[model samples]
Target: MATIAHHPATGAEPAALRLGAGLMALAGVAFIGYAVIFFVRNFTGGFLELGIGPNEVDVGRAQVLAFSPELFRYMSHLHIALSGFIASTGLATAALAWFGVRHGLWWAYVTAIVVPVLALIIALPAHYPYHLATVGHLGLIYVATGIFVAGALVALKPMLQARHT
Candidate 1:
């Protein structure tokens, strides 16, 4: 028989942490939704075309298309793999935020913010000068990243206080 350790309700967490956790959860669901859209839409047209209008092409899109068939195929695979990674990371961040909201765990606060920022960072190299073009201005990637960071900042106080205790 296994016993589950219960953590008493830590009382109402600071509003900031609650807000952060809520944002984290929102970001996670958004990521998962983005992944579904990405998979359904199928970014078979190379990287820059990802999350952007299919007819919208720019210099970067042209360059990516100039690659050899094998290279282009490889890049497409990379894009798909990245999508999966982002979805998984978002899900993990959201789940952890719940714990952070309840207990103010330092790691949860950090991860909630870091994961989305990391996703943005990951896009930097791959998307390059066309980062914004690759993923639309209103895309979930941009929106969720902002939300996660904002939420983390909002909750920073409690997280910091918890660290010293």
Candidate 2:
């Protein structure tokens, strides 16, 4: 006869961990969706959410075209690259949450928290100084950040407990 031993710490996942992972996953999806929007907007010109309409976009495009076609092309490349990076980060975050954080891995929890924080730290300040941080322009990111923060908080205790055990 074979004997099986079960440890409490290795039991079924806690509800808190599940909820936190779900929230983080939701935020990751939001980030991916935003990236898609950004990629489309690169071609469409102007952000409708920011109240920059077609006419404004057209005027801006013409000005940029007149200033330098190469510069305009470079800007397009930058937008596309930024969109790709955002989507990749989102995917990575979601994967970590689902596969790592949900399983109560401290490293996963730390990574899930760090990725977006680094991105925001690098990207957000430019928006504020440029006066581009309008509610319409940044509201979604704000909401997603809030959800991510909530998830990190919710999962923190469980992760700590798991680490000690």
Candidate 3:
């Protein structure tokens, strides 16, 4: 007799994969929330998060444009956009990886690797200690993304090697 799957929802894998994905999603959501908070808090201010100094110094005073205002504006937008993208990117891949591993999708491993890798490449580098207070905040994003990637590999290694062709 064929052994019945402990979790018919996934297949034969245990509940750990689902939990890991869920945790990753939660972390993503949290990062987005914090980014939003940062954006709002610094809207009237500036990109002091990137070590830019003196909140709201008038332009053309005596400084040598330490950071281009226009460039900072563009970078600020890019940062926000990247935050939102990273927040949502892993949403489906993570869930798919979790359930797919159990369901024998074989592609789950690829999804798991690709999702966080993309996020790391884009978001991790931006996680430098921008402001004095935000060093910890930047650290959080990097560390969280790192954990997600590492956890996915450790938790989903079995199915990433599965033949998908």
Q: Best by TM-score, which number?
A: 2
- Per-residue alpha-carbon lDDT of model 2 for 10-34, expressed as tens digits? 6667888888888997898889988
Candidate with best lDDT? 2
Candidate 1 lDDT tens digits, 28-133: 8788777766654445433443446544554443465675667666766766776698689778888887766435776666666677677767665665565444
Q: Between prediction 2 and prediction 3, which has the larger TM-score? A: 2
Q: Ranking under lDDT, best-scoring first?
A: 2, 1, 3
lDDT of 1: 0.65
Report lDDT (CA) for all predictions. Answer: 0.65, 0.78, 0.52
- By summed lDDT, the worst window of 10 consecutive residues in model 1 runs over 1-10
**TM-score to native of every candidate shown:** 0.67, 0.83, 0.54
Where model 2 places Cα greater than 4 Å from the true spot, the runs are: 1-11, 47-59
> What's every prediction's RMSD, in angstroms?
5.9, 5.0, 6.4
Q: How many residue pairs clash in each candidate?
A: 0, 0, 1
